[model samples]
Target chain A: MKLWHSFLKEMKLSARGFYFYVEILVAVIILVMILFVVPENFRSVEDEYLFYDWPEGVFEEFVLPTLMEDDLDGKIESVEVEGDDILYPAQLIESEGTRYYIFESEEAVLRLTDLDRPKIGAIIRMDEQSQPYYEYYLQGYETQRLRNVYSIFHILDFDLMEAEFESQEVRSLTDGYLELSDRENIVPAMLTFNGSMMGVFIIAAYIFLDKQSGIIKAYAITASSVWQYLMSKVLVVLVSTILSTVIIVVPIMRLQPNYGILFVLLLASGLFSSTLGLVVASFYRNMMQAFGILYFLMIGLMLPAIAYFTPSWNPAWVQWIPTYPLIQAFKETILVNGDIGYVAWVSLGFFIASGILFVFANARYKKTLVS
Target chain B: MIKVSNLYHSYNKDEHYAVKDVSFEVEEGEIFGFLGPSGAGKSTTQNIMTGLLQLQKGNVTVAGYDVKTISNKMFNQIGMSFEESNVYSKLSAKENLEFYRKLFDVETRDPMELLRLVGLHDKADIRAGEFSKGMKHRLTFARSMINNPTLWFLDEPTTGLDPAIASEIKGIIREQNKKGVTIFLTTHNMYIADELCDRVAFIVDGELLLIDSPRNLKLQYGDKLVEVEYIKEGETIKESFSTIQKEDLDKLQEVIGKYEIQTMHTKEATLEEIFIKVTGRELV
Candidate 1:
């Protein structure tokens, strides 16, 4: 009951400050940006196709008709056919009785080109040895697009003309497409970067304000223990983080992640952040010094964000960061409904880290009070 | 209610003690003043007694519990108003008092009633941060009385208050003392100590110089003299003589027979003078 009273007092004091309203406003703004602005700004890149030196009637009879038949008109914005001159940016070009498709941009260009396969009634005039070049280009767009192109080729008996082709290739390509098309990876990454990182500043400010106001000393003389006081602060920050996470996740992603697991993960992250704040606030007597260290710590904690937005640049060492497992666990639960063994392990690591930090902070709190 | 013997404290190892072997006692229902200048270990000794600081080298007890082993239950019976106003600046006067009232298990005095006693009932809803220095001091005083503690520790209780408010606070202190509250006051203001304290301890450089009733200290340190003012030959003349000897009475009679005496008064030293005479240093 004393702990409850102390928690309520802490919450009431925090609510009266401007930082509380600013935090809520920031959460609402982030949700608003995610819902109303991000999609409009993140429009998918348009698919462009260039047909070089093709017959004038080929577009109308073959490419355009194939695109219409496949219901891909909206996917392929425009298919331009240029005569003899190779001035246009064409991925595929025909010259000297050879229908050749050149791979551009350091990789095979398969998804955006109209030359996925010749029309059903088109003549199979290309040499059989040119299949290697097609196979090389086929690797770029994953297996699903390859299968669709191959199925079109099969309709014209092009696969029969080439003995290297087999049905197993289609199955492998379908599997590859499933791997690349998973959209759930982005949600957890967003939650990790946006939801958990916010607790650092909120909890730090709470601790610093109380210390500055000398209220923490008052708590020391009261019936409440240091554990109860610190836990009350951690709980308040956890609730605020959860509220902000909900505001960002519910309307923006419409994702029904296993909330129980998500809440646990968020609480662990919040506790770690809160304990870290307590340690810093206890160590530094003023905000300027605490914020200086906080910025450095924030840079380290938010390193996982780089991995979230840009996966190619992610380094192996980033996995050692505390928030890394949190991000991975969130991705697993929200995307695949995977087992929580990793989450449990990372949660344990967080608990141990927070416990050590709490011990240190409590010692510092006592020392500061005495001084 | 409070006792200390050979109390010693220092902030650093083997350094000069901030409170060096300070010893004093306060009887129940007595207003005991710890008088010292800045850096005189007045606050250090008070903090040690209030359980805010650990006793380093001596025995100190408040309300029968050793200061080192004092618990929250003991803290409940001892209220402290620090030299610095430590009230929550963001909270209103009533809110600050009410918050502290709920911290103890005992039924506390009403927050409004305490505020009224401190003459702050009109500003009950104003945030304490917005209050002037004197008002903040009064609020702190009111906060100390919230628990109706038997042992009250007030450091510079009327430091920044106006004369009227200071008088009112002194009255409240006396009233609490009448109810058997032993107030442990620490201040450099000799006037306040002389007025309210039943007994005051003079300390300097963390050492006790003297401990006695203010009246007794004044009598011991002040000159036992009487002054007479008279008009002789249409001119005023002043004469002073030591009252402790018989010859002084003869001198007084001769002056009265020789001229018409206009005024006569006994000269008693102020507490500040006694403090300076005893310590050979100014209170500042």
Candidate 2:
């Protein structure tokens, strides 16, 4: 009952201070951006590749037929150009909203890619077998998925090979996982970044504010134990983060995402973040003394987002970051077909870490109250 | 109700101490004042006694609970009013009291009644952040009484309050004392200590100099003197004579017989003067 009142008091404080409203506003803004601003699908770059063949007829044989077979022939066009149109080369020429770019030579291809765009260039030559063996030039920043699509599109043969293709079977390792659109893929990132980490910032600021106003000193002589104070704050932040996650998820994802696992994952993440805030805030006297270190920790927490967006850049060290597994778990639950085993393991790890940190933070706070 | 023996607190855990070898006691239902200058270890001793500061090298107990082993149950029997206003600024006055009242396991006073005692009954709905400093102080004082504590610890409760509010607070303290509440008041205000304390301890430089009732201290340290103002040869003359000195008394009689006496009055030392005489330092 005492814990419940403490939680209610914290809720009242957050509501009256506008911290709760600000979080809701942030969730709503993210929802609006995801719903309207971000595109549903990033158009596949199959025809966006710029090609230059030595014999100059490889486009007609390999590319044109593939475009024609895919019923995307109207989207591609060949153009011949000379003069200063050569000086300022466009990666993709637009004519009536159609992609039409001419590759004059390997020099022109290099010039087009020199503008720092991710364009794939193919150099076709005749092998000793009298068949074409191609040398491909690629901008280093292209995603693994984009590179795979480029290889699959350009490797099609005149010999249909329908029998070989029919022999291949696709299967998923997880039971309920579904393919996520580009728009849906960002839901987990938003949830982990905005929803879970919000408490890390709020709790620290709240602690500093309480310290400045001498509220903790007043509370020290009260009958409430330090554990009650710490748990009440963590629970409040957990509720807030769950509310934000629901606001962002239900509008766009509806029932497709696993709400149970998602909420558990967020509860663990919010607990970890709030405890971290408590521990860090205990070291400083007020917000001004803590501002720099707080921002530095926030930026450190954000490092995992880089590995989230670029799956190919996964380093062994990044997996050690607490939020890395949290992001992965959120993605798993939000994408619905995510590996339950991985999510469960990550959630367990967070719960254990949060427990340890919470104990340490409680000790630190006890010392802080006296000082 | 409160006891301290060989209490020693060091900020750096070194030989240098903030509170050194302090010892005192407050009997049940008595108002004991701790009088000292700033940084004289008054707050440090009070903190240790109330379990705010850890018992580093001391034996202290409040209401039968050792400071080293104090529990939440012990806190239910204690109330503390800090020198500074520390109520939650975002919470209304009533809400602040209500929230604090929930922390106690024992029966508590009504929030409205406590607010009324502090003269903040009408502003109960207003947020504490919007209150003046005196109002916030009063609110803090009201919060301390919410638990109906048996052993009350008040630290400069009326330091920033106006005379009217300060008197009201003193009245509440006296009323609580009348109901068998033992108060440990720490303050540098000599007037309040003199008016309210059954006995006040004089401490300076982390050392206790003396502990006695205000009247006893005055009688012991004060010079029982009388000043006489008289007109002699058209020049106003003023002289002070020790009433206990026979020679001065004879001179006083001679002056009364030889000159036109303008005025005469007895002069007694105040508690502030006694504190200075005891500690050789001002209570700044």
Candidate 3:
């Protein structure tokens, strides 16, 4: 009952300070940007592949057989001879109702390329070790996920040929990016970065304001425990995060994502961030003194967004950040073929982290709060 | 109601102590004033007794609870009005009191009643941030009484108020004491201490000089003297005569008989003078 009272007081305090209204404004702005400003599919229809082979028969030997083995059904319908002795004619390969133009050299590929088609070029080359490697030329408009898909496909093909293996089938871990549009794919990033993690900054600011106003000293002499005080602030932060999350998620995702799991993930993330803010706020006397640590932590939390947008750049350290799994969990809820087990594990980790941080924060506040 | 024995506190956790070997006790329903200048460790001692500061090297028991192991039940019986006005600026005066009243598990006084007691009944709806310093301090004082605490810690309650408001605050403190509340008032204001305290302790440089009733201290340390003003030879003359000195008393009588006396009054030593005499330091 005391916690509930404290929560109500906190809400009133936050509301009076215009924090509540500011969050609503932020949510509205983000919703408009996501729903209207961002395009549905960043990848255009002309964003097909154009294979370029350097030495005479690299495509015929390394690429053709791989495409045929994968049941790609690649067939050369016509070959246009350019009347050049050294360079072979461009071969038009058709498979699965799509056309792939294979060129002999870089110069010929550039010359024959249609300016209207926004094709991503795949240049094949032989390394000094006699192994085939690919260098992709991308159009400016392709998303990082699409670029990653191209790289992964070629790298796997070359690795298979070197291993003398016959595993031609490409198995995906999830239903893959095909299930989400470019605009929908960005929702998880926004939810984790702008929605759930809002608690870290907001809660720290609240603590600093209270400290400057000497409210914490007044509270220390009261009957309320430190945990109750911290939990009340955490609850306030969760309300803000939930408001922003619903505002962003409902319009774009609607019933597509599991509302229960999404809210659970948000709760975990919000609690974790709020407790972290409390622990950090306890060490410093005021916000100006704590700006260095706050900025560092905020930047560190945002590091995961880089890895989230670019799926192929998964460094070991970046993956170790707490927000990494949180963003991934948000994505899992939005997509149909998501890994529920992974989401469960990430949510558990967040909850445990929040518990440990809460303990540390509680101890710090109790010892140094009134000093 | 509050007891401290051999209390020592070091801000740096070293030998440089802010409070050293301090000990005192307040009886139930008594107003005990901790008198000291700035940085004299009066606040340190009070903080230790109220469980605001950790008991570094001594024992403290307030309302029968060890301060080192003070629980929520003890806090329910204790209220502290800080030196500065510490309140949520965004909350109204009534809201601030209401918010704090809910923190206690015991039965609490109505917020409106407390506000009215502090003479802030009409400004109850005003935000604390917009309040003047004295108004905020009054609000803080009112908040301290919301829990109906038996053991109240008041730090400089009337330090910066005007004469009228200060007098009102002193009256409220007196009224609360009459209701059997034990007040641990810490301040450097000697006049307030002399007027409101049942007993005042003089402390300086992290050490207590003496603790006694105001009348007892005055009688022990003050000189017995009288100042006389009279017209002699068409000229007003002023003189002081020591009551203990026979020759001075004789001269005073002769002057009184010879010239029409304008005024004569016994001079009593103030608490400020006694404080300086006892501690050899002036209260700021």
Candidate 4:
């Protein structure tokens, strides 16, 4: 009965600080930024479904003219205006039915040829009387490719990325640019990863307030042992992590909706990162110091990618750091298109180990520094 | 109920002992006061007795339990209140009381009664963080009594408060004593110690200087003489008589019979004077 009373006391403290709310906000902000914003910027143009037509009796029919059409009826992926000066529409790449008009930008030049101007008139009689331009024009109709809807289901069986493309097979739609699209999706994921680290520090620092106010000691003085105190802290952190996941992961999941594996990853990764944060919080006297260390760790986490892609193997041991497990979990679950179950368990183990270490460290703090 | 012998403790051991060879004893159901200056090892001795610290070479026993054998049950048997309030600041007074009440297995009284005793019933649900120092001390007193402990240890129990409030706290301590609780008190405030303690001990520089009941010490050291003044034949006259002297009794009889004896009373020693006489110096 007393134990129940103590738990209520703890929940009261947690509720007052709204520690869980901050994490939920983190998750919401990240998922929204990724699924809502990044996709709009990088959407493939070919995902548009449109029908084209022209006056069959015009002196000249234009080869192609694109129109603007979006899910919201705003920025069409590609639009071509034809007149005395005719503009050829650029081709698009479609992923999950979202089309991005690659708009002949510098980056597009290296990835694609000048959106092959259709050679329809090359073998025919549509003349440059059309080249005189205004009266005669060439016309053709095509719509963007349909989004590869099945890519969502194949996310866990990531070998589809390397497997041969077989268009006759229902699963083959997950191949080709679909695989690259997920990797490209990771850029904003990196940014949100930064924001989540901020969330970890913001919430983890609250433990220091508990330490200073002697509430932790009050908890310690009870039949509540060291492990229980540590667990209470871990539970708060776990909630925060979940909220962050909801804010960041859910929306992204909605866009390239994972088949529940992402949820498992979200939970497992949240637990791991939160535990790592607790370990960081254990060593510092205050939140500002904890944040400084978190900033350093965030930088170190990104260091391996430099080596992950660089020629020298980057010779950096970034993956060996404590924060590496959660970052790697994100990469494996999201970017590398790997098995979510494998990464989830690995993340859980890391979380358990770090949590145990954090508990031991806090117990030591109580024993030595608390007085 | 509590005993200590040859207790030596040092914070910076290489420099000096905070408490050196301190020895004393408190009979069961007795109030024992420890009077000393700041840094004179009063608190160090108390902490060691409470098992918050390990004694270097002394055998200290509390409530028939060896001090070294500190178990969870022992904490329930003894209650302690420090000079500096250690109650949870953020929690309401009732919540703070509730939290400490669970630290032991003993069945405690209702915290509401404690609130009433400390004169804090109205503030029971108020946050302790906003309370003044005196209010916090009152809440701490309430917390100390929650477990209904047999051995009560209060360090500077009434260091702050208006006189009425301080007296109210003393009344509560007296009430606890009536119930046969052994209170081991430590304070530099001689007046509180004198009025409250059944037997008091003075210590200086970690050494015990004296121990006795307040009344007995005052009687032993105070001048046992009565001074009187009278106006006779339009002349003012004054005389002092030894109250303890046998021959002076007749002189007092004649003076009271023939002339009005103007204000005659026994001389008295204050607790401060007794402390100074015993320790050979003023309090810090």
Candidate 5:
């Protein structure tokens, strides 16, 4: 009815097309709510393998035997612990004709007896590989008591007597990595796909709606200048883009509760991607032309959006592309740690350049309206 | 208030001038009609005068601002209702008026009062675009007065209206003229021009062939003498003479007194006939 009210009215009119996006977001949010609060939601984190720091030969000596690799091992005939846990270690000696072996958790080095020769090797859990000591009194011998005590790695503990072997004390610990050890390095790939690409669906939907409805010519006569109007539309599209980006990447970064940072990153990405859509949509007469141009433009975007599909594969010349700043900004703060200082400037640059692109798009599109 | 000199324009990207060598003046407080058939430069000339199109070779001054250099400020001083309906499709008739009411410096016009004036008050809540073409035209006519602009441009402003409604619009245009607003209208309806315009310009192929007050044009083109025919005893006789001449008036009285004068009256060419004779084209 009034100017501001009428502006809001037009905004509401324009927002009809956003219903599909709302549906998508509601569905995703429902899934996330179910998954987050619901138990045993197995989104099977892909199987992973990684190499870690270890003492020399420890992996082979301890780990290889558990894998069923046979090895000739000496017997622990005697043991001693003079000071503390290290006061005694079972001394190992090769057996002449006897054939038996022992490895166990929490056995004193001095208690082993009978000097049974190890068959080839005995499976000792990683937790019990070290010698134990108590009161500085220690000795070694073979024990026939097989008490099936399983340690952290689930390998059987064995107490064997050998003249040359050493005793050890090891409390089992659950093996875990502080930072997820990604041997295949999959995160950057996912980040790249999400960065400049998150707005593609919104862009496609926007052009299609405009084409289907006969509103484009009505837009041609608005009192607002072409640039301001286009920028406003970009702002509207950016709202959706930012919302979609947060919906997509927040849980991925495991930061559903981090609304502040999520908003910041989403706003940055939306401004960037919506501008990209505007620039691409400039050459289109309708929806089909928009998507056709989008594919070609994305090739250029992907070339520099290298950080998305292949971060390590970035060409030396990627920074020259227009989309590079947006990709760099999104990936730096959102995908990588919140490197806000580095990304903030890039985000600002993206916004300013996006503003310029909007002006250019307005000029280009105003010509199309006349046609 | 609206004047053009050697106005020339074409599609900026393409070949020829849509309006070529068009020049006219619409004096303040006059309804100057631009009459032409389709494909004539009537619309193009109107667009230039209204500052809707860029003039490459002409200087158009409306309400004292050059159409090119002062296009922005000039828009506020002008109100337009083109051949196409430009009202918002989603808004009711009342809502459409109110939407544009704030765009001008003038006091906001009461939407209800305006709709009632246009006989659209009963349909005030109906979407203006969904209304019949005649109703939309009336609403458009109402919309043009929203700004209370000093200069008004109406292009084929009453195309789809019934005769009764069309005459009502003509009356409203007269009222607007009496309020001292300059109206530059384009229409092919000679009845409209003959009834409403104080003066009219006949434009054809981007050229102004004739410009005069409609009353003056008809008087200039019509025969000055009156023709009469009467029936005698199984025979018919006719007489022709000027009414303005003193002796001719006395002879008409004598003839009526002498025999049964079946018909005796003055004759004048209609505006449509005059337009055809001047432009070699029918109004339709």
Candidate 6:
């Protein structure tokens, strides 16, 4: 009951401050930006095609103009061309009254022909006994567009072709030009970075006020234990962050995520952020002194934001940060049907990290109060 | 009721003690004062007794609880007013008291009633941030009594107040004592100590120099002589003689018979003078 009263008092105090309202306003603005200001996703068909070994005149005069007329301008980022070595071994033979082209890759064999100028192009992946593993056909302009661009009759196992293309493009993409188009992916990342991480500054400012007013020392002598005090703070920030996240995400992103995972991840993130605020606030006597250091720490906490906006720039080392798993877990819950086991492990890691941070923060908070 | 025996404390390990070995006891309902200048460890001693600081050595007990091992439950029976006006500045005077009132399991006094006791009933709705220094100090005093605590620790309860408010606070202190509330008062104000404290201890350089009632201290350190001033032949002459000796009585009668006396007074030492004489340090 004492804890509950303390929590209510904390909330009332926070509500009176301008910072709390500003935080809510910022969350609303982010939601508005996500809902109305951010541009809509446009599917680029050319991204699915891998062009190879087309004559220069055919690409520039016929294919380019046709693609442009089809509103597919700049749709394909890059195209591969055949060089001195043949990328795919092919056998061309004349059959009973037509011609056939057979291409073989490591995984399967593809046989194609232009007999009777077939309007539809079929891609088939066949095994050793000529058993078809997978088959897809593109009719009308899609088939013509691909044929005119690459003169390819078939792709032997689309996965094999994709693997080759990805291996070549990975290096260029790593230079920081990857643009994510899915709202599910983008919205959760924004909410995690902009919404969750901002809790640090709010919690830090609250502690600074309490310290300045000498309420913290007063609380030290009360029936409320240090753990109860710290948890009350964490709970306030956690609830506020969750509310802002739900307000911004549900109506704007239109996503139906697994609430259990989302709740766990959001709670963990809020705990980490609030405790980090406590640690920072304990170091300074007032908010002004702490503000300078908090700005610097904001840079560290916003690494996930950089990863969210420019994913290719995200480094292997960023995973070492505790928020990184939080971002990944949010992405899995919102964007993709990710592995539940992976989410569980990441959530566990977050809980453990939060526990450690809470310990250090509690010690520092007590010391600051007594001193 | 409080007791201390050979209590010592230091901020750092093996460094000079902030509070050196000191011992004193306050009987139930007695108003005990710890008087010292800044850095004399007066506040440190109060903090230890209130369980705000750990006892580094020796033993100290407050209301039957050891200072070192007292739990938060002990705080319910004791209240403290810090030297600084530590009330929540953003909260109204009433809210500040009300907030603290709910911190204990025991039923606390009405915050408005406490405010009334501090003579702040008219300003109950005003935020403490806008209050003058004296007003804040009064609110702090009121906050300490919200729990109607059996024991109160008031540090410089009227440091910044005008004489009127200070006198009012002193009245409240006396009234609390009348109700059998043991108060551990710590202050550097000799006048307040002399007025309200039943017994006062003088501390200097982390050591206790003297502990006694104000009257007792004055009696112990005051001069035992009567000073006489008289005008003789257009010249004013002054003479002092020991009142304890029979020979001095003849000299006092001779002076009175010889010249017209202008004034005569006994030299009684103030607490300030006794403090300086005993500690060889001014109570700055």
Report the lDDT tens digits of candidate 6 across residue range A1-371.
77787788778777776777777888888878766766666433221111223334543565345344434233422322232343444433332332223333322221122221242233433467645343433434454566554444343665688788888843542343333455545676676766678888988888877777777777776656777887888888887888888877788545556667877888878788888888888788888888888988888766866776676678988877766777777776664455557678887877887899899987776555656
- Model 1 agreement with the true structure over B131-171: per-residue lDDT tens digits: 99888888888888888899988889988888998899999
Q: Which is better, 4 or 6, measured by lDDT?
A: 6
Q: Write the per-residue lDDT of candidate 2 for residues A1-371, one digit (tens) a residue.
A: 88899999998898888777788899999999999998887665443335545455666677555544444334444454343365534334443323435465666666655553545556556767767666667778777986787678657863566767877898877665677889998887898878988788878888888888988888888999988988888887888898898899999999888788887788889888889888888898887888898898878877888998887788999888888888888888877566777888888888898999999998888665756
Report lDDT (Cα) of residue B265, candidate 6: 96
Q: Per-residue lDDT for A1-371 in model 4, tens only?
A: 55455556666666666555655565565556556565544544332222222235431234322222224444334565232354545444344545533333322322222233421111112344432211111223422221232224333444565464543466553333144354344533452364345535654666677766545543443333455555555555555555555555445544553436555655555555556666677677677667677888767666655544453453446656544455555555554445566666765776576667666665555443334
Error of 2 at B191 (Å): 1.9
lDDT of 5 by residue, B1-284 (tens): 98799887777645576777888888998889888888778987876665445567878888998867643446566777757665665678887787667545455468888899889999999876579878887887787777677888888877888888877888888888999999988999888888888888888777788899988998899878888897767678998988788998898878787777777678888888898888898865
Please compute the TM-score of chain B alone for each predicted structure, in the order given: 0.97, 0.93, 0.97, 0.93, 0.90, 0.93
Q: Say which prediction, candidate 2 or candidate 5, comes out ahead on lDDT.
A: 2
Question: What lDDT would each prediction earn against the true structure?
Answer: 0.73, 0.84, 0.85, 0.64, 0.61, 0.75
By TM-score, the candidates rank as 2, 3, 1, 6, 4, 5
Ranking by lDDT: 3, 2, 6, 1, 4, 5
Candidate 4 residue A17 Cα shift, in angstroms, is 3.5
List ranges where model 3 is wrong by over 4 Å: A44-178
The candidate scoring highest on lDDT is 3
Q: lDDT value for candidate 1?
A: 0.73
Task: Output the better candidate (3/4) by TM-score.
Answer: 3
DockQ of predicted candidate 6: 0.37
* Model 3 lDDT per residue over B1-284, tens place: 87889989998999998898888889999999999999999888877777667788988989999988879888899888989999888889999998988899899999999988889999999999999999999999999998999988999999789999999999999999999999989999888999999999988889887999999998988889999999989999999999999999999989988999999999889999999888888998
TM-score of chain A of each: 0.66, 0.78, 0.68, 0.53, 0.51, 0.64
- Top TM-score: which candidate number? 2
CAPRI docking class of candidate 3? medium
Candidate 6 lDDT over B63-130, as tens digits, reads 88887776778888888887788787878999888888888888889998888888899999999989
Q: Compared with the true structure, what per-residue lDDT tens digits does model 3 show for residues A242-301?
A: 998899999998888978888888989989999999999999988889889989998999
Kindly list the per-residue Cα lDDT of model 2 for residues B1-284, writing each as its tens digit: 99899999998999999998999988999999999999999999988877777889979988999989878899899999999999999999999999999999999999999898888899999999999999999999999999999999999999888888889899999999999999999999999999999999999999988999999998898889999999999999999998999999999999999999999988878999999887889989
Question: Of models 3 and 5, which has the larger TM-score?
Answer: 3
